[model samples]
Target: MNPVLPHNTLDQLFLSARTHFKWLPKPVTDEQLHQIYDLARMAPTSANCSPMRLVFVKTAEGKAKLKPALDEMNVEKTLSAPVTAIVAIDTEFYEQLPKLFPHADARSWYVGNQPLIDSAGFRNGTLQGAYVIMAARALGLDCGPMSGFNNAKLDEIFFKGTAYKSNFLINLGYGDATALFPRGPRLDFDEACKIV
Candidate 1:
């Protein structure tokens, strides 16, 4: 069996991690982005239908294209961050099922099923987005994930004529902890779970 992670590792990945709004002007390299995705992709997905797609906007021109799509509250922090990842879902992700899930003919299951396609794509893609965050944290990077943006506009600007649709955005870099607000409270397990 795999060993439990060390306390410090857990703390880095969860307990002490915060959503940062300010960055330290350090860059997140392209290699690090690739490492994040490489690690995240190894996690589970339904029928191996990995639908998540990412667009890392690190260039000034890319950020400029993305600016108008961001909500007012998200603009400054996102623009100032070293990298902002566009977490998206591929509507036609089943096309890769033959390669990703070679043991079964999974592609046929969603060939013309729009509802199933939408449901699986969004759910699995969002799960992968969470994996991305954990992977980034594991690699000593900070993340600020937010949904306060115009999805339709972002899709048009970044994914026009493609099968991809925006789900959320994550600003990534070394964070400015001095700018963090006090940590928020979480519900106790008793309040959020059941022993069924």
Candidate 2:
């Protein structure tokens, strides 16, 4: 008999995942942050064209720099968190398609179409970003992901002349339940998904 079988399950974890976000009791160490990236990078990406980039802001300077990028309502929260990661997408992800999906001429599919490149780059990068969130949870870190900031402003401040662009920002640390609000509702699967 084969030892491998389809016996994995995610229901228990999914069912319990309520964005409750009662943060941790201690700090999120630098070593642990490195482990999160080590796991997040393993997830699949389009043609291996990993478009995502992470700017981990933990030092006082880095965190302070991110403060101006947030809305007035979020600045204090972000500043309080132990760390914030700038999740970004590489506009030139296609340049790595050959290395990621060498089985076919995947590079040609995006080489000429600017729109197509943007679409795939953003899509896959976003996917990876989501993966990072889940992995953070799996690794015992609380996450507060937000996309309310200005993308152009982020590009101007963080990306500068680089090909990478910020997709969203995520605050990672031990939650301070003292400030946590009630859990938000979510649509049921039937309402959100269709079998057809």
Candidate 3:
């Protein structure tokens, strides 16, 4: 069995990690982006139907294209971050199940099922987006995840002619602690879980 992770590792991945709004001037390198994906992609997905696709908006042109889609509250934070990841779901993810889940005819399972296709794509894709945040944190980066955006507009700008659909955005960089708000509270186990 795998041993428990060290305390520092756990802290980095969850406990001490904060959703950052403001970023330091430091840049997140391309190498770091690649490394984040290499770590995140190993996480499991149903039928290995890994539908998540990412567009790292780092350049000025890309950010400008993205700006018009953002809600007023998300505009400045998104623009200031070193990278904003467009966490998207590929609607046609089942096409790759033949290679990703070769042990069974997984691709055939969703071929004609529109509802299954939509649900599975969104579910697994959202999970992958969480993995991306953890991976970034493990690499000592900060994250600001948000859903306040016009998804259709973003899809038009970045994913035109592709099957990918935007689910959310994650601003990534070295964060400015001075800009943080108070940490919010969480529910107790009793409030959120059951022993059944």
Clashing pairs in 2: 23-174, 23-175, 24-174, 24-175
Best candidate, TM-score: 1
Question: By TM-score, highest first, what's the ranking?
Answer: 1, 3, 2
Pairs of colliding residues, candidate 1 = none
lDDT tens digits by residue: candidate 1, 1-196? 9999999999999999999999997889999999999999999999999999999999999999999999999999999999999999999999999999999899999999999999999999999999999999999999999999999999999999999999999999999999999999999999999999
Worst 10 residues of 3 by lDDT: 8-17
Q: What's model 2's TM-score?
A: 0.86
For model 2, the superposed segments whose C-alpha errors exceed 4 Å read 1-13, 18-25
What's the lDDT for candidate 1? 0.97
Candidate 1 ranges beyond 4 A from true positions = none
Instruction: Specify the poorest-scoring 10-residue window by lDDT in model 1.
Output: 20-29
Clashes in each model (backbone N, CA, C under 3 Å)? 0, 4, 0
Candidate 2 local lDDT, residue 119: 89
Model 3, span 99-180: residue lDDT tens: 8999999988999999999999999999999999999999999999999999999999999999989999999999999988
Alpha carbon lDDT of each predicted model? 0.97, 0.80, 0.96
Candidate 3 deviant stretches above 4 angstroms: none
lDDT pick, better of 2 and 3:
3
